[model samples]
Target: MDETVTAVIDDVVARAAAHDADEPDRLRRWRVLEPDAGRLLWFLVQSSGARDVVEIGTSHGVSTLWLADAVRSTGGHLSSVDADPDVQDAALANLVRAGLDAHVTFGTGDGGAALAGLDEQSVDLLFLDAERTEYPGWWPHPVRVLRPGGVLVVDNAFSHADEVAPLAALIDEHPGLTSTTVAVGKGELLALRSR
Candidate 1:
């Protein structure tokens, strides 16, 4: 990462850590994105000039906050989905505290189904951080909704490499996308549309 970007990520992590410390319940339930992972996500959004980002999971809004901040900087918007209402409520509070409420929209329901309902070619950035084992099932719909040249970021792709193998294979078979696996936080697979 560039020095300026590194500094920004450090600041974001410091803020997130402080917030997490202030809320023990949230800290217990959600793992805030490590500095590097947060930086990567921020970089992706800025690089892509993404105006509409979709996130499949919003645990305690840690990643949500990170993405929202990046989107706000770019004058973009974020829509996140999570099945747990409690988690969504907590995430909402976190986003509010972060002053990122204006940039975010939260949906409560099955992530896959929620994503499927979105209009095609509507999202600029799609992030998957939900159940690892359900990645394949959750991935296709998001890809379908992404516009040509959109980016898909899948978290825990390396940690759950076995579970993600099929998805990886599919990506490998597809000529329209290119992916890179990074060992950030848990692990992240970033697939950018090449078509």
Candidate 2:
């Protein structure tokens, strides 16, 4: 990432931290992927030369910005999903601030519904950072939409192991997927579908 993008990410993250501190009791305000995890997401998109990325969860656009940065380089576009209009607006503003808004399309309401609407084998990268328990029920779409060799990155694997275990076990049962749990920012459950 360039200095400009770096500065924007740092500023956004700091502002988000402040907001969380100020609004301690807010429910949805509790979930922003750690900076290291965000960077890893960025690197994966960049290195894979992934053009079609579908990201579930656009919390404050922190992760979306990182993904948008890579998509911009790859001449790709990102369709990011979030259920809250306010959060979507905040994410849109942040993307515009970073000059990455052109690389993204924002969807509001029912992320799972949005995800289910995708075409088969249409995605190059699928990033799951939404509800933990809801993941298992939402599994089939990613499995269908993600092309062979696509990367599936699930957030909060270790941090929310119990809640996300079913999805983890589901991945384990899929013979075509090779998986690993990496201890980087809330822990990521990374998997690659076989070709």
Candidate 3:
């Protein structure tokens, strides 16, 4: 990322941190990804040439800004979904401020339902930072929409391991994907969809 872009991202993150802290109740379950994790998300997307990415959570668009940096380069787009209208609106405003609005599409609703609505094999990357335990039930949608060799990233495996253990186990046991957990921010479960 360029210096100008980096500055924009930093400013946005700082603002989001304050906003989240103030209204903890409203955005409690929908926490922002750690700065370390945000950097990694940007690296993964930038390195992988993933054009079409779907993020399960978009709290104030902190993570989305990172993804957008890479998507902007590839001329691709990112679609992010969250259940709260207020949260979604906040994210949209943040994106606009960051000058990343052109690379993203914000949606309001369940992540699973949003993923199910996408075309099959259309997504190059699927990122989950929402409910970790419910990951299993939503597998089919990502599995169907994620292109072969596409990557799926699940956050909170280390920070909230017990809660996300079922998801890790299933990913490890699944036949169509290969996964490994990296010690990035909070630990990220990175998997590649194999045909």
Task: List model 2 lDDT by residue over 1-195, tens digit each.
Answer: 777777888888888788788785646474687999998999989998999999998888888989999999999999999877898898888888889999999888776788789998899999988877788888777778888989899999888899879989998998878899999999999989885
C-alpha lDDT of residue 72 in model 3: 95
* Per-residue alpha-carbon lDDT of candidate 3 for residues 97-144, written as tens digits (9 for 90 to 100): 778888988889888889879999999999998877677788777678
TM-score of 2: 0.95
What are the per-model numbers of colliding residue pairs? 0, 0, 0
Cα-lDDT of candidate 2: 0.87
| Whole-model Cα lDDT of every candidate shown, in order | 0.79, 0.87, 0.83
TM-score of 1: 0.83
Each model's TM-score, in the order given? 0.83, 0.95, 0.91
Candidate 3: residue 145 Cα off by (Å): 1.6
Tens-digit lDDT track of model 1 for 101-128: 8999999988889888999889999988
C-alpha-based local distance difference test score of model 1:
0.79
Model 1, stretches more than 4 Å misplaced?
Answer: 1-28
